[model samples]
Target: MFLLSTILYDKNHVLQNNILTTLRHVLSNITMAKNEKHSVKLRIWFYSGENKVLGKGRIELLERIKETGSISSAAKGMKMSYRQAWQMVEEMNEFSKLPLVEKQLGGKSGGGTKVTEAGERAIIAFHTLENKVNAFTVKEAEKLKF
Candidate 1:
């Protein structure tokens, strides 16, 4: 998607130096998986000991839980099974200092899942940073493509 958009940006942000030229060369190689029907982009990657992260699946999942007020409902909203959603939340809990989703015990209406304030903050920060970095990457790639 970004690659496709870049063909039209060169005239808008062209840089003309070896540093910028080298930067462009590097950016041209960046790639992302995108859906044609919805213009959604997916990024997947692994991290080493320092624990860098990639992709937005977990964050989005948490947002859904917050929106629907239940893990099962969130999973359904995301088109994933309940088991899958639970596993994701579990894995995130194991790795992070903060737990992303919180669950309530049963009452008259039964129990439900909710995003903690921390979780909501994480969602907002993760998405905001992702948009910025992905845009930077795209622009850098544009420099390289020529």
Candidate 2:
């Protein structure tokens, strides 16, 4: 009788362990499947004929310049050097139909930078287009199977 009971207890223990292991495996697979879902991503840039003009980084830099009123301050905020920021501004000015930024001469207060009307329009246009593209991509992402 004791032997029969011991044999039954061992078999029950093994069966429980097997069930638990199988449950763990299934749960892990479900979690992995959830995490492995496909998504879409994109980057956008404006060009002047064959020359690349503006993109995310330049737009952000323009925004920073607009906010701070100083190119050096904007560069510092972006963790970039002043020279690099200046070069970007120069490139943008060259590519744009109107100069995107202008320098104000020093006076009683101090010299500063400012974004022109065109720069503001460019910023708004880029954000609007980016939002539209993002919305389209999100809607399309729903159709993905794998």
Per TM-score, the best of the predicted structures is: 2
- In candidate 2, what are the lDDT values of residues 74-126, reduced to their tens digit? 99999999999989988988988888899887963588789999999999999
For candidate 2, list the clashing residue pairs, or say none: none
For all predictions, the C-alpha RMSD in Å is: 15.1, 11.0
User: Compared with the true structure, what per-residue lDDT tens digits does model 1 show for residues 25-126?
Assistant: 566655322322333354643333566332478777877888889988889988999998888877776666676677887974799988787777777777
Error of 1 at 9 (Å): 48
Which candidate number has the best lDDT? Answer: 2
**What are the lDDT scores of the predictions, listed in order?**
0.69, 0.86
Off by over 4 Å in 2: 1-34, 105-110
Judge candidate 1 against the unseen true structure and give its global Cα lDDT, from 0 to 1: 0.69
Model 1 deviation from the true structure expressed as Cα RMSD, one decimal place:
15.1
